[model samples]
Target: MKTLVISSSPREDGNSHVLAQSAIDGTVRAGHDAEHVFLGDYVERMLGNCRHCRRSSDGLCSLDDRYETLLLEKMLPADGIVFAMPLYFYGMPARLKTVFDRLFCYTANSAPQQDQVINGIMNKKVGVVISCEESYLGATQGVIAQFQELTRYLNQDLVGVVVGNANSRGEIVNDPTDPVSAAANLGERLYTSRVTDYRLDTARSNKVWDCSPVGCPDR
Candidate 1:
């Protein structure tokens, strides 16, 4: 299966980036194709919204920016999606929000009308990998909530969520099997199309292939 990994941290050597790389490693190791997109690189510049996207029937954004190249054509057709991000000010960054905001064009399967329906963007497996300073229970609550609402509306399957405790740039590199291993585990699960309740700090596994004989392990 093809997996798209959206690395959303501006810092190339930051904790969030470190985990992102690990996730990509896991994805590549799992024998799947991946497109690594650094949000900071292609999304640094955003065009002013003129709402031309709303008029299109195919959910095409006429914003004349990279959204058409990066998100619509690339992200939509991917078999699995992974959002690698870092919590900022207890929420997501403006750039990441920009991407989500622009998705309004594709929020539905058809144009606005009685026959309009959810586009089912969530049918593909969704995974979240977060890096934040605080390791508190809900440090990534905002990200999780966004995914919850997104998956619910899109009818997508949320496969996994991995939160890495990190602060300074490259702080997670020194840390043992945390953001590194945890991130990889999340990526590996993308191939199996299975959601795991595993945590890096507590439960860590090296298996990437489907191991369950009774069917999908957890939904």
Candidate 2:
């Protein structure tokens, strides 16, 4: 399967990014094609409310911007999309949230003249990878609810989430094996499942496919 991983952390090698890399690594190891897009590396401009002007026919953004051509193009036709971001003040990062905001062109806020693509948002599964400073990782419920609401708008499935405690660059690598193992299994589950029924709380606890009876990579 083709998977698109979006890293929303601004740090060059932050915890969020480390978890994202692990997920990408697991995806490739499972024989799937995975590509990562670092939001920090891109120039995603903040967009305003759809002007609803006759110029709406121009599916492109009114402002001459980079995302209009680059990241937007990649988002199209991907089977699955993963969002990796560090929790910022109990919520998503500002820039990443801006990317989500820009995607509103596909929805009700679209300008009347905006050249919005028909069925611009449909038929994709979404996942999340998060690394927080707290050891207990207490924000899964809120994050899952947020993703669920957003996915409803995009008509996408909220497949799963991977939350790991990470305070330093690459610290997650040395952290407990369960979350990382859970991440790898999540990649495999995405490949095998069809209807997307996993719950964030249970998935993290069940540790599906993390390790086999013999301790081999279950994936």
Candidate 3:
């Protein structure tokens, strides 16, 4: 199996990057091929230019940027994807969000191979690791909700989510809950487990991952 791990933190060696690296380590230990990409390095290349132009002859984005390469070469061929990032004002960083936004090209009417693009992106195993400063009950709710809807729309299986509370760079290692280990475990599950549907359970009482320090209040 091949897994693509994308870290969206601008700060090198930050808590989110550490967690992402741990996930990659787990994936490799599971005998799966893992590739890591730092989205901060490609922010300038993912300009959401797809919205302005029609799809190319190959039914891919018309932009001459790296986004098309990342999508067609790295992401489409992977069996699973792990998104790692620190919460930015209760949401994902702009660069990471831009990547998702550019995916709209795959669904555009001009794309000749829309079904192929859809199949390439959908029904894959997905994992998420988030680092946030606050451990409040709903601190990560916004981002969580966004991923849930995204996975649902893509018909992807969202296998697991790990949330760590860390304010400073590389502070997640000091977190008593040890979300780093949880993230690694999630990566292992991404390679080992097979689930057709891992959609969000609306009836679930706790929306927050249990690893949070403060923990979610019982509803």
Candidate 4:
């Protein structure tokens, strides 16, 4: 099985990244191949919120950006998806949100409300690893609420939601069975439920929108 772990922290060695990498290592230890993707690696190449929704008709994004490869190669085919996010203003980072926003393309061909279209994540399971500075109970759940809604909309199965408490690098190591280990376990646990069809329409790579209205780079 292939597990794709998405590290959303801007810093390469940030706590979130470390935990994500650890999860990947655990996934490998459990007899599976995994990929640890750093969002910072492609953030600059991404033009978030293109506002075109052209994929709805053309079966492809309107604007040409990094999202095509990111979605096609890593996201669509993966049996399991892990989102390692660092808390910002008690919520997910903007870059991760940008990635999530682009996912609207998955359901582009169907009506916004629901003319009946089953696409996107299908039966894939989603795992969330949250890193927060505050130890308050609501800190992590606050973000989980948003992700829960998104998973429901995408028709994804949210298998796990783990929270890591730390601000500095490597601090997550203190807890022997905390998020770090949980994340690693999640890598293999998702295999309990699998989707038979793992291919999606990812051939098109054209962006056909003029999204200067939101003005989020690449304008």
Better of 2 and 3 by TM-score: 3
Clash totals in order:
1, 7, 0, 4
In model 3, where do residues sit more than 4 Å from their true spots?
45-51, 55-64, 194-219
Give a tens-digit lDDT track for model 3, residues 1-219.
Answer: 999999989877899998999999888888899999987555554545554665555545566557767777888899999999999988999889988887777667766657667889986899999999988859888889899899999988888889999987888999899999999888877855544443586454443344465764321
**Candidate 2 residue runs with Cα over 4 Å from true position:** 52-59, 108-120, 194-219
Return the TM-score for each candidate structure.
Answer: 0.76, 0.77, 0.82, 0.74
Q: Please name the candidate that would achieve the greatest TM-score relative to the true structure.
A: 3
Query: After superposition on all CA atoms, what RMSD does each candidate show versus the true structure?
Result: 7.2, 5.9, 6.9, 15.1
Give one digit per residue, the lDDT tens place, for model 1 in 22-72.
Answer: 888888888988888888665654534436434455444455557656765
Compute the lDDT of residue 29 as modeled in candidate 2.
85
Per-residue error for 184 in candidate 3, Å, reads: 0.8
Where does the lowest 10-residue lDDT sum fall in candidate 2? 109-118
| Least well predicted 10-residue stretch by lDDT in candidate 1 | 111-120
- Model 4 bad stretches (over 4 Å): 45-64, 110-120, 175-177, 193-219
Q: In candidate 1, which residue ranges exceed 4 Å CA deviation?
A: 44-60, 108-120, 193-219
- Give lDDT per model, in order: 0.73, 0.70, 0.82, 0.72
Greater-lDDT candidate between 1 and 3: 3
Candidate 4's residue-wise lDDT over 59-172, tens digit each?
Answer: 445565566577767877787788998899999998898787666554554435222223435656788888888788887787899988887777788877778888887787
So what's the TM-score on candidate 3?
0.82
